[model samples]
Target: MTAETLTVVDTGRDKKREQGQAELVAAAVEAARPGLDKIPDPVEPDGDGDLTAEEKERLDTCIGGVELLSTAFWIAGKSLDTMAKGHLIRRIPHKLEPERYYETIEEWAWLEYGIKRSRCAQLRAAWALGEVLAARGYHAPEGQVRELVPLKRKYGLNAGVAMYEIAVEQHGADKVTAQRLRDLVKLLPEDLALKDNDDADQIARMFGGVLEHAEPKALSAGGAIPTDVRRGVDRRALDLANVLNRRRIPRTEVERHLLEAFADEEDTTVFDAVLARMKENKGK
Candidate 1:
């Protein structure tokens, strides 16, 4: 009331701040609204989707009521680390777990926005790719999103996105359709299919011509990876890393209790060596 009664003047700073806030909110909404289908069945939310104290404040204030849910978004820092966690932190209010407030995303979306579950899924997917689609004026959106779903399912989300970018580069955006994207992902070597985010990124840049091809002596050295090439060392490292991302077997369980996690005793020595090397690398 006091602010309304008083006239305020700005020296452009206010406008810039407001614009920044608006952009953050828009990006947050997109990140948070991942497809309903993407949610796990048992729904193992990251760290059980625990809301930080800051997140709790936003739920109460930003989404003050059902009326605000559709239009409002909470601010979360948009870093690469945070991006992977976009769906995890943003949508906890909708999971149907008792401790988590016993609401389903389907019902929650319906109650807040009057949108169907399927429509929510599509909107979630589209918004997720907003940046990518924005480049082409979002031409042929339906066809684009349609293919993205399958690509995401086959290779994890990051890999799918890499493939999409590669597809756009190889085949112009105007011609890049659902079928075209499908054929591109299929063409990826089997060894490359399950790539982690970094590997996917390098491949995307290499294929998309963003990465300069370094070939003075051998022109073709900068291009194409064939199916038969062995990825023995790198692939094994990635597989091991993925396993380690989950629960690591306790040393006490393996050494003291003599668990069969490793069939051979020599493998235990190898694990110790790998851990030492990892620690050494981290320091550097």
Candidate 2:
């Protein structure tokens, strides 16, 4: 296939569809919000049993932002009216709390093998973060604009953490950066993955792992396989030795001694290729 064709194939149509849904949901919520204070019955009702294939189907018509807001508004026990509340309760699990809502949503969406409510929930989270950031006098970084456009094309307005991570990378992290992130997260819709500061910190630690492994110097340092892959390689080496051994090399000790072979080029080819060449009069 030509390059152009390949690009088209690689394009994430699912993400684009998600983003489009978010835009629509955003419009609906905005319209709904202004009338909220005037409405008497603000709580949407809950769906008691399993959603039918049709109700499950309508859930797809909703996007991430809508699900999130619906979750929040539902949990808050506020809806535009009894009619609206009935509509929501009939549509989604009314019994489940916002935190547990994703589980049910994921199941239904996955069952259909089409656009899922879980994706919309993620997008809504991203959108809330953006809203919080904008409220704090921030904007997407200049270079990130191009990248975000594609992500937005794929993921929608809800690509919050990733978008912020890019911004932080480009702009540099400090008190302001951290503050903005914390602030934005505070505005997340109900049923967001984060429960507390620890949750946020866990995510940060995960990102730290990414950065630590992403260093160019580390990548270029022989482009060695990762620790897990190294374990597999070492196992292979021991199996090779079991073949060579008058007494086979012990498989149990393979992980420990693989490092030793790595140190010398001569022993290295089988176990430590780097160490194997260091040996004198060795031919393989």
Candidate 3:
């Protein structure tokens, strides 16, 4: 046949495969819904020697539905990962308006695939990370790439990107292995994951002094300080108090200083007392 004829034949095959896949996905969803609906009801045998007809039917339906739903969900997750990888590698977004593809992907994920935007974002980030890995001569397996995306998303996008960069820099591109990347990802502080620098900084400042003391005490004593032990102070306050006392400042002294500093301010007594209580609990 001619080149044009061959092209037409290839297109037909592609369309047929696409149609078949769509049908299968629809069938899976349809099958899963019935199972999901029955999940709330308990599937128990009747007190009699045998289960009633309705109970028997419900048990069979619920079990089969759950199994089908589980399999369908697994398949759907794999398919999404594959689609995300293809979209990233092919630079599909560039075919349309620049950056429009990100929004388009979110919309398509929600409308067509019933996935949320956050999940789509995870897939996108995973694909981008996978590309980076491939370029560095570390081709991560498909499952590994998918697994890394959720960890990256936990830190938010900017932080995730920053982590990837940091990992590459700390562990030379050539030396960076999948396990090394996983370890580096885990090292990221939860506070650092906040997208806003101001928020992250504020948290660090608030908990910084307390964390230093609390961590050691918890380690040495082998227990965490329970919150709600004091009227105004929580576990965090207790931690801060412990740290201050470790520096040789007495709880009473700290309380006196705070009370004097806030004497002019109204409703400062509660705050002062909490600090004093924290100091009292220090070292114990």
> Residue 222 in model 1: shift from native, Å?
32
lDDT of 2 by residue, 44-118 (tens): 434678876755554554443343453353222222233232443334543435443333433434443343564
TM-score, per-candidate, Cα-based: 0.34, 0.24, 0.28
Candidate 1 structure quality by residue, lDDT tens digits, 155-211: 655555676767777777767878877655444433333555565577577445422
In terms of lDDT, the poorest run of 10 residues in model 3 is: 213-222
Residue 74, model 3, lDDT: 38
Full-model lDDT for every candidate: 0.49, 0.44, 0.53
138 in model 2: Cα distance from truth in Å? 3.4
* Model 1 RMSD vs true structure: 22.1
The better candidate by TM-score, 2 or 3, is 3
What RMSD, rounded to one decimal, does every model reach?
Answer: 22.1, 25.3, 16.7
Steric clashes per prediction = 0, 27, 0
lDDT of 1: 0.49
Question: Tens digit of lDDT per residue, candidate 3, span 24-55?
Answer: 99998886565455564764566867877877
Ranking of all candidate structures by their TM-score, best first: 1, 3, 2
Q: Evaluate residue 124 in candidate 2 and report its C-alpha lDDT on the 0 to 100 scale.
A: 31
